[model samples]
Target: MDLLANLVLGFEAALTLQNLGYATLGVVLGTAIGVLPGLGPVPTIAMLLPLTYALPPESAVIMLAGIFYGSQYGGSTTSILVNIPGESSSVVTCLDGHKMARNGQAGLALATAALSSFFAGCVATVLLAAFAPTLASVAFKFGPAEYFSLMVLGLLGAVALAHGSVLHAICMILFGILLGLVGTDITSGGQRFTMGFSELFDGIEFVALAMGLFGLAEVISNAGRQDDRQLVTKKLSGLWPSRADLRRMTAPAVRGTALGSLLGLLPGGGATLSSFAAYALEKKVSKRPRDFGTGVLEGVAAPEAANNAAAQTSFIPMLTLGMPSNAVMALMIGALMLHNIQPGPQVITNNPQLFWGLVASMWIGNVILVVLNLPMIFVWVKMLSIPYRYLFPSIILISCVGVFSVTNDVFGVFLMAAFGAIGYILLRLDCEVAPMLLGFVLGQSLEAYFRRAMLISDGSLWVFVERPLSAAMLILAATIVMTFFIPTLTRKRTEVFREAE
Candidate 1:
């Protein structure tokens, strides 16, 4: 009953002409960005953050939220049309989705992606409406010590989820922490890590850093790889799937949605993790597991559904609990705070329209997304025909413009170039960047909570253990470390995942 009433109210709020326009604009921009290589949600959102200051908070957030999920919707398009994945969550899609495209079923694969994502988004939106307030209530009880511990565990989980050497991830995290310290120190009344530059007083802008690291670095990397093109040249037919295809996909989509919604709430990995988990689950549970990676519709549907579902549910923690699971969430957190709106249980009660309106907008956005994508498939496919040389340079220019736009400083552009070089080096060396990005976002918040907890407990480190929740979290972190380091358990888990084939 409560959820029903909120949805009604949300519809009322989101139905406004202006808000609807923003939503449309957001989804369109998101789709375009997703179709273009080297652009993702984080930098795009970061670039747009400044513009939101002039709009109504509800409208601003609605637009931004649309961009997030809209990118998710568009990511599969690129992955299926080209071998390139526009978003990290779509990485697994390239495995089977591109194969399906190669087999001249590009239309069917795209249609599956569109429909599955729409269904997942709708289901997740309903879940968000139902549970956000209750979850927020639970989050409100967390004290500084508990929050600090949660962040510690979050950072650890991020490192564990990273694709490469844990040691390198840890080092990158430390570097992020150091970079985070460059700003003015509020506690000590002293400048830290300014390196004697006057502009350093304001600290390095998060927008600049994010755009540089992700947007610019990706552009440079893609530019270097232009000569190596892998795209599907076959014409496509049958925008709608056959009855048999639907029957096969239904179970996976449902199961994937459940798994994704649950995993999306976790502090790290979220959508990306959910996609991988869904792939593994479908492969394990399917009657013919050997059919995977060979253009099976379920192979394409499961991960696509799961990742999109997770992407929607990820808003729960950021909006209701003030806890950010990833860099994108961190940016959203910053945006919410910038609007003078505090995230957590209080938000639902104090700002019902903003809460419910955002929820409502997601459903509407998904509907629009499905309708828009079906007709735009040909357009997106045509995008693949553009020469990589021309497209990549424009992307690099856009990235530099975005970086400079954030700070209006040439130094920020220089910083981006430096990070691009570093990113290229890390790529060659097989180092993980996601963990570093996660650490950079959480470092300051972790430090702030840690200091606050210490102040409250008179510098007693045991306070973390004394608190039941914090203690449990610490124990879980320790367990993960122990399990991963133990040769036997690590081998077993790895073998289990591999056996799903």
Candidate 2:
């Protein structure tokens, strides 16, 4: 009953004409960017963040939230139509979605992706609303030691789930932490790694880093690739799926929604991880697993559902505990801080309107996405025909302008360019950037908490281990780190013996 009352209040706030207008604009832009190859939500949101300064806090947040999830709705379009994933989460979709398009079932693939995403979004919103307050209550019980331990656990989990070698991921994370420390120490009021640069006193600009790493780096890398034009189907046969396709997709979508909702609650788990896990789960459970890569409707439906659901639910930790699960959520924290509104348990009680309005707006945003995506499929397809040579310059210009506008300084532009080169090099080395981003975002908080915990315990190193909750989290973190290395050690030993023989 209380939930119903709160939701009623939320609807009243979100249904206003001005708020609805912002939601519409956000979803439209989100879809457009999501349909463009190599333009993921992190870069899109970072690029548009400067524009949000002109709007009210609630409206700004609502619009940004729409873009974050709406991209999930739009990403599958490129995957199915062009065999290119517009977002990382859509990579798995390309495997079966493109195959379906090649087999002349493009319309069916698009329909399944959109419908499953809509269903998952609706379900995930309900889960977010119900679980957030409970999580916030639990978060209130945490102290500095516990928070530090939790962050350690989160970083470890990110490394464990990150793609490629665990050693590389750890190195990337350490690099990010070092970068994060390049500013004035908050407690001591002394510069640590400024290198005599005044701008370094404020720390690295997150917008510059994000745009450089994701936007310019992507543009440069794609430019170096051989330009093979995308092949899109000319005729999208039927707009709606047949009964047989629906029957095949129904169970998978439901299972995917459940899996995604659960995973989204974990630290460092978001849309990309959820989608990968969903596809893996589907393959494990399917009676005829051999058919998974052969353009099965289940393959298209399950991952789309999982990514969308996970995207929505990933907001839970950010809003409730003020802990960002991914780069997108980290940006949301930055947005909230810009408004002078600290996120956490107090956000719900102190700013009910913002909390409820954001929740209610998600539902409205999802509806808008479905309506826009289905009828405007051809428009998005037409966009794909635009050559990369023409698009790349505009993207570069926009990224530079956005970074400059944030700080009103050309120094930010230079920083972006430097990071772009660094990002390009990292890409060539096959290092995963996601874990590094997470580490950078968490580093400040982790440092603050560790110091506070030490202060409280009078410089005792055992303070973290003495607290039950903190001790448990540290134990979990150590276990995760050990799990990754133990198998590698055994494999290396066996390889050495084989070489000797």
Candidate 3:
């Protein structure tokens, strides 16, 4: 009954004209971005972070949330039509989606993606609303020891699930933590690695790092690549699936949604990971696995469903525990901090309207995505005709302007440029920077929790081990690290990612 009442309050807040408008705008822009190959929501969201400042907190989050999930709907459109994945999560969709397009089933492939994503998204939202408060209640019982242990587990999970070499991922994590430690010491009132620069005293800007590492660096990397795509069809037909297709889609969609909802709660597990795993799972369980890359309906349904489900449920940890499960969630945490809202267990108790309103907004946004994607498919298809070269310059310009708007300081621009160069260099080295971004975002919080735990325990190290919750987290963290040391798991990890590639 309380849940029903809270949901009613949420609908009241989200149904306002202003909130609805922002949600619509966000889905529209998100779909546009997703239709453009080689563009993903992370950099786009980072580039637009400054714009959210003009909005009320509820509206700001609602729009941003819409963008993140709506992109999943847009991504599969290009994957089927042009054989290009607009988002990394759509990579698996390209396998079967493009084959279907080549066989003149483009409309069926696209409709499958849209319908699967919508169903998964609706289910994931329900799970989030029902489970978020329950998890947050557990958070209320946590001490600093548990928090610190939880962070350790999270950082380890990021490395474990990373794409390439675990050693390289660990190195990036360490580098990010070191970068995070470059500013003034909060407790000692003394600088650690400021190097006499007044700007360094405050620490590197999160927006600058995000822009440089993802936005500017991506533009540089994408500058030379040319889009050679030829659309399969401009006018889609056969809008509704046949009964046979629906029967084929049903089980895979359910399985994908379940995988996504569970994996989305783990650190570093997001849409990309969920989609790939779901596609692989479908292949593994198929009666004839050879049909997987040959325009099978299940292929389009499973991955699309998984990615959208993961995108929705990944918010659980960030909203309830203030622990980001991925890079995008880290940015969402930054957005909340900008509004002076500390995201954690107290977020529900202290700001029920904001929490419930955001939840309701997601449900509304999914419907908006389904409506926009099916009717406006041609508009998105035409957008693919724009050359990659034309988009890069505009993206670079927007990024610079957004970073400058932060503090009106030229120093921020210089800092961004430096990180951009560094980001490009790292990309060339084949290093995944997502783990680094996660480390930088969580470093300070992890340190703070650790120190507080130590202080409270009168300098006793056993406090962490004494608490069952913290001890279990640490044990899991240790187990994760140890798994990589084994040759079998290491080889298998390489094989899994290699197959993904």
Candidate 4:
């Protein structure tokens, strides 16, 4: 009854004329951006980060969150149509989604992705509404020491869960930490690595960094690709799945949702990790394991569902516990802070409207996305028909313009271009940028907590272990790190960490 009443209230909040308009706008823009290859929500959201200042807080957040999941849907469009994944999590979809396209089932692939995302989003929103308060309550018990240890554990899990050479990922994380330290020292008044620039005092702007690294860099890299190869012009067929297809996909979707929802509760690589985990699980459980990579619908559906669910549910820790496990969530934390809403265990009791309204909006938003996208499939496919040379230049121009608009400072444009160059270089080197961004975002908070914990203990380091929860987290972190080094455990860890890149 309580849930029903809150949901009714949520509907009242969601159905408002202003909120509905924002929801529509968000799904539309999110789909448009997601359809474009080489641009993901990170840079786009980061670029638009400044714009949230102008809108009502709930509306802004709803729109931003819409972009996150709507991209999940849009990503598969590119993956199926062009064999180019619009987002990392969609890479697995490319394996089977493209195969389906080749088999002349592009429309089916798009439909599957859209429907799967809509279903998963609905389930995840329910889970988010029901479980958020309980989780927040548990989070309230965490002190600085526990948070610090939890962060450490999160970092370890991220490394263990990420794809690519573990060594390289670690190097990127360390470099990110260094970049994070470039601003000012939290404990001491003296600056650590700022040469003399006043801009360095506040640390590198996350918007600038993210826009440069992910957005601009992707544009540059894509520009260099062979023009003929960049466009996906395949003719599509089969908009509807057969009964057999439905039977195969249903189980994966449900299983993926369960796995994703659970993983979303933990910090770090939640959505991405859950997607990969779901794929591996699907393969393990399938009777026809030999058909794993032959564009099985189950293969496409499972990870797609998992990634979408995890993406939505990742908000659990962020809204409730004030912990952002990834770069995107970190940005959300920034968004909440901008609104003067301190995210923590107390947030649910204090801001029920914000919490429930957001949840309600998510449900409504996903429905809007699915309704809007079905017809837009024709439009998105036509987008592939545009000449690459014409599109690439426009993208670069728009990216530059977007960056400039955000800061209105020429320096920010230069920073974005510089990072774009760096992003391209790292891409060529096969280095993953996600972890670096995550590390950079988390670095400041980790430092603050570390200092606060120390101050409380009068500079004693043992405070991290003196608390039971903190001690347990530290132990978990230690175990995760040690597992990578042990010969017997290395294989399992490597398999778990291996992701599509």
Candidate 5:
């Protein structure tokens, strides 16, 4: 009954004229951006962070949330038509989706991907709604030590589950922490890494750092890329799936949803991991494994479903425990903080309207995606025709403009450019910037918690070990780091991501 009432309250809030408009606009923009190859939500969201300051907090979050999940739906289109993944999570869809398209079943593939994503999204939203409050309630009991330990676990888990070497990821995390420590000491009012610059006094601008690392860096890398994409088919017919198609997709979609929902709750887990795991699971379970990559509808349905489900459920930790599961969630945490609303369990009790409305908007956004995708499919296909030359310059200009708006100063743009160079350098070194970003995001809080814990315990350092929950989390973090060194586990971990790529 309480759930029903809360849902009713959610719908009522989400149905407001202002919130609905924002939700619609967000889905539209999100789908548009997602259809573009190589431009994922990270850079896009980073570019838009400054712009979000002008909007109401609820509307801003609702729109950003739309972009995150809506991108999952749009990525499949690019993978199916051009055999290019718009987002990393959609890479698996290309295996069967493009094959289906080449076989002149582009329409069927698109319909299957879209419908499967929609179904999975709906299920994930329900799971999010049912489980998030309970998780948040549990999180209400956490203190400084617990919060600090949880963050440690999250950071370690990110590296343990990421797509690169654990050592490199650890280096990036340490580097990010170094970056986070560049300003005046919070406890002591003395400059540390200012290097005689007045701007460094406030520390690195979050907007500039994020925009540089993700937005500018992406542009710099993609600016020289050649576009050799050729569409498999321009004319899409048979937009509806057959009864056989539906039968084949239903089971995989359900299974994918279940797997994705669970994986999405883990630290460093999101659409990419969910989709890969789902594809592997389907291959393992299928009776006709030999036909797995020959344009199977189940293949198209499963990963697409999993990625979207995971996209929705990834919000669990971010909203409830304030732990960012991935780089994107880290940005969302920044967004919430910019709005002056602290991320954590208090978000539920202090801002019921925002919480419920955001959940309701997710379901509505999925409905909007289905409506936009099937009938308006041609619009997205047409977007592919636009050349890279025009897109790159425009992106760079908008990013600079957005960065300038953050501080109303030229220094911010310069800072962004500097970070863009750093981001490029890191990219060349085969280092993932995500762990660095997470470390930067969590560094200050971690330091504050550690200091506060020490202050409470008279600098004994045993408080973390003394608390059962904190000790357990620290042990888990240790276990995660240890697993990567084990021969069997190391090989298995490498294979899982390698299979996806």
Candidate 6:
């Protein structure tokens, strides 16, 4: 009864003229950006963060959330049509989706991706609404020690899940924590690493950092690259799938949705991981596994559904426990803080309208995406013909303007440029920036929790293990760290034995 009443209230808030308009605009812009290669939700959201300042909190969040998931719907377009993924999550889609396009089943492929995404979005939204409240209840029981332990677990999970060397990920996370500490200490009234600049007093502006690392860095990197994208010029047939096609896709989509929704709830898990995992799972289970790389409909359906489901369910940790599971969610946290609202368990009880309204808006946005994406397929295909030279300049200009608008300070622009260079350097070195961003976002909170726990325990280091929940979290963290080292050790031992032989 209470759930029904709450959902009714959420609909009332979401159905307002202003909220609906913002949601529509967000989805439209999100799709447009998603159609453009090299532009993902991280940079898009970071560039547009200033735009949310003028709106009410509910409206702002609704629009931003729309952009997040709407990109999932649009990402498959470029993957299928151009053999280029518009976002990281769509990379796997290119494996089979573009092959389908090349084989003249482009329309069927697009229809499958869109419909599968819509179904997953609907399921994930329900899972979010059902699970978030229960998770919030569990989070309410956490103390400072437990919270600190949980953060440790989250950070470790990120490192474990990140691609590339675990050592490199750990180094990046440590660097981010160091960067996060470059301001006045919260507990002590003293400055730490300001280097005598007043701008450093407030710590680095997250907008500047994000826009630089993702938005500006992307522009600089792509500026040097030649455009080699081969657009699918083949005429697309009717958009609807045949009954046989639908029958083939239904089970894969369902399984993908279930996998994605579960994965999205994990720390550091989001659309990219879910999509990759789902594709792998499908290939493993399929009787015709050899057909996977040959443009099978199941390959398109499963990954598309998985990424969308993961995109929607990724909000759970951010909303329920105030833990950001990805770079995009970290940005969402910044947005919430900008509105003077602390994101956590209390958000459900204190800001029920905002919480439920955002959930309700997701359903509406998903429906809008299906309607908006199908007919506009031709339009997006046309957009792909636009030259990168013209598009990148506009993107860079907009990012500079947006960063400047944050505080109307030229220093922020300079900061963004500096970080942009650093970001480019990191990119060249093959460092993953996501974990760094997560560590930066969580650094202060982790420090505060650590300090509070120490105070409570009278400086005893045993306090973390003394509590049952905290002990379990720390144990999990240790286990994850060991898992990484164990495999490397085994490989090294085998190599040594071969050399001796």
Q: After superposition, how far is residue 134 of candidate 6 from its true place, in Å?
A: 0.8
lDDT of every predicted structure (CA atoms): 0.80, 0.85, 0.90, 0.79, 0.90, 0.89
Show where candidate 1 strays beyond 4 Å: 227-234, 337-343, 396-418, 488-501
Query: Which residue pairs come into collision in candidate 3?
Result: none
Q: CA RMSD for every model?
A: 3.0, 4.0, 1.1, 2.8, 1.2, 3.8
Best first by TM-score, ranked:
3, 5, 6, 2, 1, 4
Model 2 TM-score (2 dp): 0.93
The TM-score values for the models, in the order shown, are 0.90, 0.93, 0.98, 0.90, 0.98, 0.96
**Candidate 4 residues 1-501, lDDT tens each?**
877877887788778898888878877777777787766787777667767767788888888888887888888888888888878778888888888777777777787888778889999999998988778888878888888887778777767666676777787777777888887787677887878877678777666777778777777777766645343445556777788878878899998988988887676666677778888899999999888777788888888899899999989888886767676887787677657787778777887777777899999999898887887788876665555567666656766776666667777778778888888898889887877876886777788889899999999999999999999989998888887788877776666555455
- In model 4, which runs have C-alpha deviations exceeding 4 angstroms? 1-5, 184-188, 229-238, 242-244, 391-408, 488-499
Q: Rank the candidates by lDDT, best first.
A: 5, 3, 6, 2, 1, 4
Candidate 1 accuracy as TM-score = 0.90
lDDT tens digits by residue: candidate 3, 355-473: 89989998999999898888888888899999998999999899888888985788888888899999999989988888998889888888889899999999999999999999999
Candidate 6 wrong stretches, greater than 4 Å: 488-501
Backbone clashes per model, in order? 0, 0, 0, 0, 0, 0
lDDT of 6 at 407: 66
Q: Give the runs in model 2 whose Cα sits over 4 Å from its true position.
A: 488-501
lDDT of 6: 0.89
| Model 1 clashing-pair count | 0
Model 6 C-alpha lDDT per residue in residues 1-501, reported as the tens digit of each score: 888888899999999999999999988888888888878899899888877878899999999999999899889999999988988888889989999988898999999999999999999999988989999999999999999999989998888777666777898888888888879999987998889999889898888898898888888888876778777755888599999999999999999999999888888888988898899899999999999978999999998999999999989999999998888998999888878888899999999999999999999999999998999898988888787899888878888898888868999999999989988898889787888888888888899999999999999989999999999999999998888778775465344323222
lDDT of 4 at 315: 92
Better of 2 and 5 by TM-score: 5
